[model samples]
Target: MTVTQILAAPAAHTAGTAGPVRGRRRALRRALWGAQILIAAFLLFASALPKFAGQADAVETFTRIGWGQWFRYVTGTVEAAGAIGLVVPRLAGFAATALIGLLGGAVLTHLLVLDAAWALFPAALAAVCALVGWDRRAETRDLLRSVAGLPRR
Candidate 1:
C-alpha cells in the first residue's frame, strides 16, 4: 500500500471512534447526575424522619443537631422539592443549583457548629454536585438561555 493510503486509514478509524466516545461520555454524565439526585433524596428522607421513630442512634443524632422539629420540617420540605427537580427534565439546572447550595450549607454547618467527624456527608454531596454540574454545563447553559428573564415561581 502507498504511504498516503496508510495515513488515510487512521483518519477513517478515528472518525469511527468519535461516535462511541461521545456515547460513553454521555452515559457517564447521566450516571453521575442520577447518583447525585439519589443521594439528595436519601438525605431528605433521613433528615425528615421522626426522631426515635425507628432508630435510637438516628434519634440521638437528630437531637444533637439541635435544629429543632420545625427546622427538620423545613429541611425535609426543601429536600423533597430538590428531589422532585432532579427527576424533572425541565428542572435539571435548578436541581443542580439547589443541590450545590444544600451540600455547601451542610459542610459549613458541620465545620462551624456541629464540629463532628461525620460531616463528610455534605462534603461528599458537594463533590457529586461539582461532577454533575461539570458534566452538564452545556445543557445547563442552554436551559438558562431558554429561561432568559422569566420570573421564578
Candidate 2:
C-alpha cells in the first residue's frame, strides 16, 4: 500500500466509526433526560402537591416523625423546586443530586421512624436520581468546576 493511503486509512475508519457512537450517545442522553423528567414529575405530583395542600396523610406522617407541619411545607417547597429544576437541561444533574439527598432523608426517616418497608419508595427514587446524576456527570462536573472558578478540563 502507498504511504499516503496507509496514513489515511485509520482516519477514514475512525470517521466512519464515530457516527454510530455519537448517535448512541445522543439516544442514551435523551433516555436519561426522559427518566429524570418522569421521576421529577412523580415527586412533584405525588409527594410535593399533597404536602403543599396539607393532605391528612402528609400531616400525619410529619406529625408521626415529630416534625411540625411547617416542616412539611418546607419539604414540599424544596421538592417542588427541585422538580422544576430537573426539567432544565443545564440544571438537571444538580437537581437530581439534590433530589437524591432529599430521598435519602426520606429513606432514613422511613427506616428509623416509620415502617422499614415504607423506605422502599424513597430508596427507589434515590436510585433513579443517582442513575440520572451518573449519566449527567459531565455536566455536573462542568457546573461545579465553573462554580469553583476552575478551568474546564
Angstrom error at residue 103, model 1: 1.1
- Residue 125 of model 2 has an lDDT of 82
| Local accuracy of candidate 2 as per-residue lDDT tens digits, 92-120 | 88999999999999999999999999899
Clashing pairs in 2: none
What clash count goes with each model? Answer: 0, 0
TM-score top scorer: 2
**C-alpha RMSD between model 1 and the true structure:** 9.2
Q: What is the lDDT of residue 133 in candidate 2?
A: 75
Candidate 1, residue 68: Cα displacement in angstroms equals 4.6
Models 1 onward score TM values of: 0.65, 0.80
- Any residue pairs clashing in model 1, and if so which? none
When summed lDDT is taken over every stretch of 10 residues in candidate 2, the lowest stretch is 3-12
RMSD of 2: 8.5
Tens-digit per-residue lDDT, 1-153, candidate 1: 432232233332544565654455545656776786686567656654443244565445546678765555566567777766666666755676777887787777777777657579878877776665655555566677777974432
Model 2 C-alpha lDDT versus the unseen true structure = 0.81
